[model samples]
Target: MTTSVDHDVSPDSSRRPPTEMVQLKHPGRVIGAVFALLLAFLLFRSFLTNENYEWEVVGEYLFNEQIMLGLGRTLILTAVAMTVGILFGIVLATCRLSENKVISLAAGAYLWFFRGTPLLIQLVFWYNLSALYPHLGISLPFGGPELWGGETNKILDLWFVALLGLSLNESAYMAEIVRGGLLAVPRQQTEAAKALGMSSWLTFRRIVLPQALRVIVPPTGNQVIGMLKHSSLVSVIALPELLYSAQLIYSQSFQTIPLLIVVALWYLLCTTVLSMIQSRIERYYGRGSHPTTPTKKSLRQRLRTRNEEVAK
Candidate 1:
């Protein structure tokens, strides 16, 4: 007698779920649509109620040379402040993580003072620095020649006060961001670098910082955008930034709402553009570690492969 072969298959094998047909819902899209509708309705009502709500007036003020110049100044201040803030933040965060008690204490004190107080108060304080100290000067610890030059009243200058206050305030928050990023880096990374005979600086520069950048960049971008808007607060000191310029225009034209709208629109535009840039940067950094698709290929290589497949 000959043995017979049986080909039995499980039922589940033939009844696999269709993942390709699965539908996913996005709540964000719905919420955004609703918010857009509400905003449009409010804008329409404002236009109808205000006989002086001329779109041309808004455009004119927006494009005015003086306003544009003020906008440029605002951008410059934001860039300078953020740059200085992040630099100082790195130092403060590193100090906080240091073994030295003095450095840690100093860093803690800075964060405590800045974060505890309102930014507005800091601005005013900086604007009136001359009142606190009649003659300001910088010198070496052992009392050498002055570092450069200083004038107490000079601090009250709009740009000087804006820069000083913004940089100092931003540094506190940046310290937090840097600390978080540093903490996100696994302890094992530092240990491994040390095991390989790397110096602390080398380990941080080569291994830790590169990884931490992914975590830090998004928040840093947010801070940059916030700084841009916060620069408007310097208008209190008569800085001719976008908002101040708008105020001057409205003061003359008596178009408060319209001028205010122009300022809001500019802020919206700047924030939107910055957000787009942030998204691109985040996407770039996230590409390799993306959960949806994990691959070791370089971005250019991946693009090339896709192009080849499409051509085929």
Candidate 2:
């Protein structure tokens, strides 16, 4: 017997309701988010209701003339000291990497001494350097005739001493940072540059340095922020900086906590701005590498994505 097959199928045979999609429930994540929000709300409420915080005082001195001047001085010190540190650090890093044992040893010695000693002592020592050297000038080695001379205290003023201490201290840290960045570049890149008829200096300046900056800029930015805070140590030498300015105000006003709050707020603001700039620099240098960088998404966008995925 011949079997009969249906030539046409009914639409109902092919059609069925779309599968209901349910998003996976993460109860733990929801709990964690709720806990974090509660904690943040409590902290914020405390800040608003706390009587001793003296938000008014913070607002009053936030843009006070003395505070503004101190802020400017702090910024200047950080800029100049970091500039000197980066330049000297590059030299030190090069010396540390030199083939000559003596050159490398010298760099190592410099790093050891600076990195070993306390920065506070260094600042104090420089401030009191006139005690050791009665006069200051350029002279030949081993007490050779002085080409130029000046009184030590006059030449080594507070500003000069502060800068010297900060720059020297920063250079030691930056040296290691620079050396690490340089080492991050592969050996083959240098070899390839040489094969392409590039001079050693040209290869470093054009090929290695740019690539190394991806490693360098981040730590350097940290060093910059550290330098900004570390600058408060200069207050011991009576150099007027941000923290010192706050101290001066509180000393007279006797509103110690409020003045400190002012300083803390200013620091937070400055550091926040610096952090944004650092992120921008990082993104700029991080282009073209594998494992693409993730972009930030807002909460609303994320929720929308979650809903769409669940619908799918």
Candidate 3:
């Protein structure tokens, strides 16, 4: 009787369960999606049919040379200012997080002054800086021969002022973002690095920052897009960015809405590109956060290597 024991009654087979696939359907979700699509369709139809948009003029001036030049200036300003801001922001954040009170206070005061003021006000101030300080100079600590001196207006042109205003303001905000990211790094990780005889700076560079990037990237991206739009404020000082160029044209042509639509479309295109870049960066830095997903950078590097080998 005992010899008739079933082989299928083994522990492994007992633990195995039959596979069943589930497909969830919610009528409320379907209805809500349909309603949203209907609303979007109606809104788009209105835009297409509306005469006020002046689509013909928008098409005509979309690729105008003046607009292209202005867009180039906008791109240059965004790149330069963000580069400067991020660099300065690193220093400021380090100061704020340092052990010394004097350094931290200095960084705090800098942030307070810049962040408290509106960006538009800062732009206006920079544009009119000569009114307050007619002369610009660099002097030694003991007041030796001035290293450099010039009239503020001569040196601080509209372009320079725009860069200064954007960079200074952005540095304040970026410093805060950087500080938050640094603070988010776990104490245990730093302790472990120190145990391995790593210097503070080396540990920070190799361990802390690599970990902090997962937190830092989202806000940094937001700052980038914000800086791009903030560059528009320079138009008030006649720096001739995309919006300003459109204004210059529409002032003569009386096609305000059309030119606005054109630039608006361009801005939308730019932000879309930036958003895509932000996603790629986020994915590259997120490999450890999600174990199952793969990174694009490795695949891209492999493909590039293959292409170069083929060329060779």
Candidate 4:
């Protein structure tokens, strides 16, 4: 006996031609071309101007040992200050989030005082610390030995005071950035970790912080760039950073605009480099979370295909 078998097929199961390809946007190409032309035109016009800016002057200052040294110092100061500031910021954020009233209150007061005051005033305050207090020494809260001793003026004379002031001032803003990042983390994440028997510290380190870093890094990068530029302010106290070095050169040659141009170029270079770094960091942190283009196959289908391949 011959048996007739019935087959069922859905018309929609048939594959259709790939949808018309969407054109990739080239916004950057247009912007870049326009900007490049504008820059070239400006440079050509500057060269033809009667002021006759000496390109040699720019080259000389650019390669000058004093200027280079000052640039190096500025970079170092920025790096050190940002590092310390971020660390202090983490501490402050933790304190602000603490269950203890005293800790939270102290953190709030610190943030308020630093954020309320001007950075320039803070710098001047550090520079003139000796005037405020003649002697500097570590005193115990209860009854311990005075472990440290130094004259305030002598200590302030060193770069230490400037570093301290910059770090402290920056910490206020950094604290806010950190707190925002921490708050951005979902409370359910903490609860889930706790449900899994993870301790608070472990949960924070492994789960919350890693996710919060995505939110924190962007603003933190901005703060770092700001710190680099703000290092110029220390020049008022004879820090001899890039801006001050330029000032010294212009004072001698009286080519104020040219000297200022050199400074501006260096700042542009630094900020540009920093912005590239920020982009890379953001991309790295965005890996899995970024919206991906969906393919025809669902995730389960993809996984089944992989499993089949493994079986083969």
lDDT of each: 0.87, 0.91, 0.91, 0.87
Cα displacement (angstroms), candidate 2, residue 207, comes to: 1.8
Candidate 4 structure quality by residue, lDDT tens digits, 1-312: 999876687554564433333457899999999999999999889776746577667877877888888899999999999999999999999899999999999999999999999888988888888887999989787988888978888867747877988999999899999999999999999999999999989999999989999999999889989999999989878888999998998899898877887888898999999999999998898779878876745655676666565544
Candidate 1's TM-score reads 0.79
Scored by lDDT, model 3 comes in at 0.91
What TM-score, over all chains together, does every model reach? 0.79, 0.84, 0.84, 0.79
- The residue-by-residue lDDT of candidate 3 on 167-281, one tens digit each, is 9999999999999999999999999999999999999899999989988898999899888888998989999999999999999999999999988888889989999999999
Candidate 3 Cα RMSD (Å): 9.0
Q: Which residue segments of model 1 deviate by more than 4 Å?
A: 1-52, 138-151, 293-312
lDDT tens per residue, model 2, 91-205: 9999999999999999999999999999999999999888999888899999799999899989988899889999999999999999999999999999999999999999999
CA shift of 222, model 3, Å: 1.4
lDDT of 1 by residue, 55-127 (tens): 7788777788888888899899999999999999998899989899998999999999999998999999988
Candidate 2 residues lying further than 4 Å off, grouped into runs, are: 1-25, 140-145, 293-312
Better model by TM-score: candidate 2 vs candidate 4: 2
Q: Which run of 10 residues does model 1 get worst, by summed lDDT?
A: 14-23
Candidate 3 runs further than 4 Å off:
1-25, 140-145, 291-312
Rate residue 164 of model 3 by lDDT.
Answer: 95
